[model samples]
Target chain A: MLIPGITIKKGVCQLLALNKFSVGQWLKTFDTIIFDADGVLWRGQQAIDGAPDTFNALRAMGKQAFICTNTSETSREKLCAKAQDLDFLIAEDEVMSSSEALARYLQQRKFNRKVYIMGGQGIADELECVGIESLPLDEGKMIGSQMVDYVKNITLDPQVGAVAVGLDKDFDMLKLAKVGCYLMDPKVLFLATNRDHSFPVAPGHFIPGSGAMVAAVESLAKRAPFSCGKPNTFICLHLLRQGVIKPERTLMVGDTLYTDIQLGYNCGFQTLLVGTGNNSLQDVAKLQRSKLPLMYQQIPDLYLPKLSDLLKFLPSRNC
Target chain B: MLIPGITIKKGVCQLLALNKFSVGQWLKTFDTIIFDADGVLWRGQQAIDGAPDTFNALRAMGKQAFICTNTSETSREKLCAKAQDLDFLIAEDEVMSSSEALARYLQQRKFNRKVYIMGGQGIADELECVGIESLPLDEGKMIGSQMVDYVKNITLDPQVGAVAVGLDKDFDMLKLAKVGCYLMDPKVLFLATNRDHSFPVAPGHFIPGSGAMVAAVESLAKRAPFSCGKPNTFICLHLLRQGVIKPERTLMVGDTLYTDIQLGYNCGFQTLLVGTGNNSLQDVAKLQRSKLPLMYQQIPDLYLPKLSDLLKFLPSRNC
Candidate 1:
């Protein structure tokens, strides 16, 4: 929560104008800073340079800094190990992941059901951690069938209640056909982990995220599922539950305006835009000229080269 | 030509609703029959089992059968080779691909300028064949780079005149970035080959068809491109040029109600829904429940199980 150089008077104006300087002031002002890992701290293994210094600066100011990554690839312990390797102090509770959020949400809801999953082990593990049985394969000959097939095949059974959609590697024609069939029954509740089309690029190349699979099934069944991560308000609620952020005073900073900035806008928090991630400035300008939501343009109170650039405006005392 | 067991009658309705005995009476009713290859005679490969017999039956009746496909994959020669393998006698000019339609439309418009293409060889070849230069790759320094990195990056060129979007495997982030940057200039005209999300299942896994890349760039740019294929009346106009089938008398047989039926309706052709491929019965049923476009649920005059199902309705002489 320490900004390195700005005076208190300058900090006040920064917050009011909500400019890039104000974002740095806000980062210094808060006791606990939550960072979205992908765009904020790092993209895959290559850490965003200055991420460690920023976190170290926060700790030097006697504030708590945590990484809230949407990635389900790493467990909390692994994340802590990575954080330590990056020269930052991180604890299990200080790290919140979509996988963990999904697990917690499922446990709290106590929706006793068998989730027919079309995703990765992270999704299945999350469901199982909540004491829910996970079914990975199609049991009722719904495979390779159309929407009407569900009514004829699986909906008759009370055991089959909900369908969970996520990134499924081996998901092919049979899985898609089955998901489409199952979705049309109307009795089954559908849940999409996230609606991202492509995740952050890594050595493996860009893989199709959950949204493509979700989109394929959604288009066929003509039904939208309950999305539960990133831009979804549910993730914001999870952040609030951890007592890490006060909605009115918090700021969400990231490279993508649609997800990170939009999340901030929805949560009544200030936002900062970094121009180095999923979307480009030209895309933003295009949206500005068209039917893009007004709140989207207004959502980001600041624009910075990257999250690290905020350091320059930090209050000297806080640093 | 043969419509399963139905007979043609004195009028259009009578011709559509007649039984096998009366089919002989309607044999001489229509002078031309147009077929869509993707869903009718064959799907990617391995012809529809009963296609050869149906074509032979129609040939016996002395009906002019024309194969009109929305595919951009094959040229007239390749299409003929495939049809021959399926035992259907098709002339080179009798088959019309959407690529040809796009070529003709572009040639007639006489743009006579460079086109930044993101499609197959068919599109590139068509443009070249019509004396137009293809300019798909990045030309020079892109506009909107606030920094002087443009001076260092040779890939960003500003000389592109137009962008034509079609199916291509080379569609990647760099291409999209270039397109986005070029589009920001406002002088580049945008064109899309088609708007289908997924094509028929081929030997390899489902490739990201043109529409996928189109949607990605379109979402960022927030603009609709000029469609040059099915559901767009341009191709229908091309068919009308050859005096092959009177627009009013033509029957468009396709499995997809959206593209095929919509194209048929737009072209003033009676549409026959063949539900055994691509779209299913429930897909149609869903449209019936909504206030969709007229073509969505204005039930086709005939519902054939497949293109082969039409064999039952052909005149006895045709069979």
Candidate 2:
């Protein structure tokens, strides 16, 4: 029996019920496709069984596929290298992460301002490349003498220009107080790097991320911070400004309903979901039951068992 | 020949009018008196004319005259030395500046929070004495560079906890932008080191002071800054907290009608104005037609030619 409210291609409903046609078969109509990493390409130690073949088949059908991830863990080049190691054909630019978007955004600005960053060297290095001075919060034992003054001086100096909020393990009250005081002056601007609540690390645990800190400051300041990374329209607009992708035909695909699907949906792009990522089938069902509903009504236009199953879904090129 | 609104003693009135007994004796009512520096001692240079003779006359009356100048220009040691050079007797603590009040206030609260400053080294040093970190806007440069990134990286990084607005020469659009963005975050606390709109410089020129910058940020953030200088109730409250002076008995005397007189009025102290200072006799006269007509209603209780003349007006110890 067909699941209530589940609409598929007319007459194709019968095909779905018979279990003969998987949802992956609908991929043929689109000339371009975007894939999500992690759950789609691989779960952890092993690659998804059908992903590699599906990608190769899509190429054979004269279709282009790109992967967009919100992961700050790896650069676009590194992501591409990982795909190459997995025996997949992918370009460097095709692998876009929100971190990369943040880096790109900072790169194009015509500002000589020095940045005191809390994020990894990736962000620092990116900022420097654009002629922006980058001061990473130092972490060394020999400089411990200056560290006391440094911590004390953190937000109290008007010379700081701006305080770049990013991921840091050593975050504490002093930092909070300094930021609070510095922010109280309306002349200083507060920018949020991203809005992801958490990023997956291992199977059973998810790490607290930027969204936590952002929420903390937002609650205190009683203002919404301008978000720079994924799902926020800024990153998307920046991407368009860079001529990286055609917004009209661009598709955003991911396993996570938020950050991925909503980003595509909100930006008026087609979205696709791959099972076995941040959310499982059970998690989606539970989300549907929750009172504070997720944007599940804005679900992906297409769904697949895994990234590799896409090859079988594409219509015959001759047809 | 008597001034229209002049209040002369009954006997003095009869003697001066030659309607009664001859002007045999004139009783000087006040002797011992305190003087505030910014408006009373000297505004940016040459001393008030009658300042010296007034003190000398008080001393002649066996009155213990003290020079209390709240000029944060020099340390207690320097202030005492300066007073000596200016022909006045004053102790280190007797020359109380708002800097001292701020330091004491922060110390009492054990506020270890970093203070982003836009003032002189005096403010920075004062905050440091209380173990509060100080970030001077001048030396640290404009914080706008850091602010842009701060606003952009709000979610991913640490936010400024408190913003201290003070006097800075290099205060510009960049500084304003940074401050503006920082204040957008609600967690940030807004403060003004002082609300002095203009600092007296040379004879005919004035530098737009901290109040101007504070006003700029306050306008954007839509909130009044927590000011900690003369006229601001914070310093008054701080003094009260430290048991330095009681609001009722405390008398604030200075030349500037805005800072000195307004402070005294707000703190419920008797306010005395020296005729010559930032607001000259001409400025005061012009106030009669001011846009805010009732502003002049809050006039000083005692108006003297200079701080020195104040000794002649105060009620005598024996009288």
Candidate 3:
């Protein structure tokens, strides 16, 4: 039976049953695919079944696939290593993590400002890869000790022109205070990796994510940082502008709608939602019935129970 | 010349010129006085001249005075010691600090749950004084390291019935996450000492105050702590209910209108704004012209340059 009110093939047509739309149907119109990792390709560190085979089959079909994740902790090399270890066939250059996007965005600008980071070693490594220096990660600990006296002790360096915050284990008052100090100077760029408030670590457990840490800094700084993640479109659009990817022919696939599907919505690309992650098809159907401000949030173009379901959609039995 | 539009007396008559309306007149109505320490009685650690003498004079006039401060770091004994060093004599029992108020608030209920403290030694001392145990101040640090994995690692002691925040010199993420873990129980009391965002350190310098720290925790916990400071009236009224003071016969004096004067407004006590610390006469006059939502922000009942000015209002005073 069809799940009524689902979005597919765009003109607001009567939607078909869930998973009825095939990858062969999606591939007919789209040549490039961008995947959100946590839900689509894998959960935590585990590779979802049929994921690697689907990507391997897509490559055999002369299609391009890229990993576009908001995971700020892992470096590009690490992401590629994880994919390789999981037997997912993807090139290292094809992985566009939020940390890498931040690095590329800064690299494009030739940003000279020594950055103060409120993130993990991945961002530090990426920033260093581009020759943009970031302040010591533990600087928050040292400066925060003196913060009890005055913010004066946590002074901003004249060259520190940007403050980048991502998922960090060391999210503390010192880093937050240092970020607040630099933010006082109006010239500094406040770059945040993403706005995800919480994520599932295990099936039953949820912990505060980067969005929570970013908000703590944002609250004190009285400013919002521009996120370099999915919804921002800076990552994929950067590739599109270079003529490597065409928005009209690209499909953005993910488990979550707000970040993954909205990112596709933002970039004017076709979006596919899979139920193997944070959001499910029922959640989307229920949202469509309610009042939500963002148009992108109300629905996704097409959704499947899992990425592996697309395997059945391939027209060729060889697929 | 008197500052026009200032609040004075019960009839709301134009405030008299400065301290021109003698203490002789203030004594005729308000027999008991509550003082905010930082700006009203002293700036930083220095006491204003004639502050002790005025208190001594009020004592001689058969009046009652109480020190109601939000200084969380200092114990009641320390407050008395500081008063002694400043040449002011006050009974230890009469001192009501935020830490002490929290102690009494917990004591009244006979809370069996151990408390998590995001403050200094004084609150810890005060809690122990009332037979309530507090977790180690650095417990946040120990538990916070495991937060990256899961909030479950930051175990909430079944006995930790409350989390109280104040001006902690060692504010960090670990402490915030721990506080958040305890707050998840919903039954845990979220107690904050005060909500002072910043305080004047010297002539022109200011430091991030306890309010900033409290806000960080409040943001993560998704709740506001019950403030046990001057403006909240929890402390003042707690004593009032015990028959230790009467609101009708009391005057609340402070330098800052928000914390000090608002405390009086909340408790229905006469309020006097002193200029020697912060929120000068000109500042109040400026705020009066602008529309304000809170009644206390409209105007205080009176204004004086400093506490010493009250010495001139003393009856039968000898040079």
Best by lDDT: 3
What would you estimate as the lDDT of candidate 1?
0.62
Q: For model 3, what is the error of residue B50's alpha carbon versus the real structure, in angstroms, after optimal superposition?
A: 4.5
Residues B115-225, candidate 2: write the lDDT tens digits. 555455666666666677765443323232233333333231133456666655444333444565556567666767676655434332234455655654665555776
Which candidate order results from sorting by TM-score in descending order? 3, 1, 2
Give the C-alpha interface root-mean-square deviation per candidate.
Answer: 13.9, 15.8, 4.3
Docking category of candidate 1: incorrect
Q: How close is candidate 1 to the true structure, as a TM-score?
A: 0.68
Candidate 3 clash figure, as a count: 3
Order by lDDT, highest first: 3, 1, 2
Query: Where does the lowest 10-residue lDDT sum fall in candidate 3 chain B?
Result: B6-15
Evaluated with DockQ, which candidate comes out highest?
A: 3
Once model 1 is optimally superposed onto the true structure by TM-score, how far is the C-alpha of residue B164 displaced, in angstroms? 8.2
Q: Per-residue alpha-carbon lDDT of model 3 for A14-44, expressed as tens digits? A: 2235354533354678789998888789876
Candidate 1 Cα misplacement greater than 4 A, ranges: A1-32, A43-49, A59-65, A102-225, A241-244, A274-291, A294-298, A304-319, B1-30, B42-63, B99-228, B241-244, B275-286, B293-298, B304-319
Q: Please tell me how candidate 3 rates in CAPRI terms.
A: incorrect
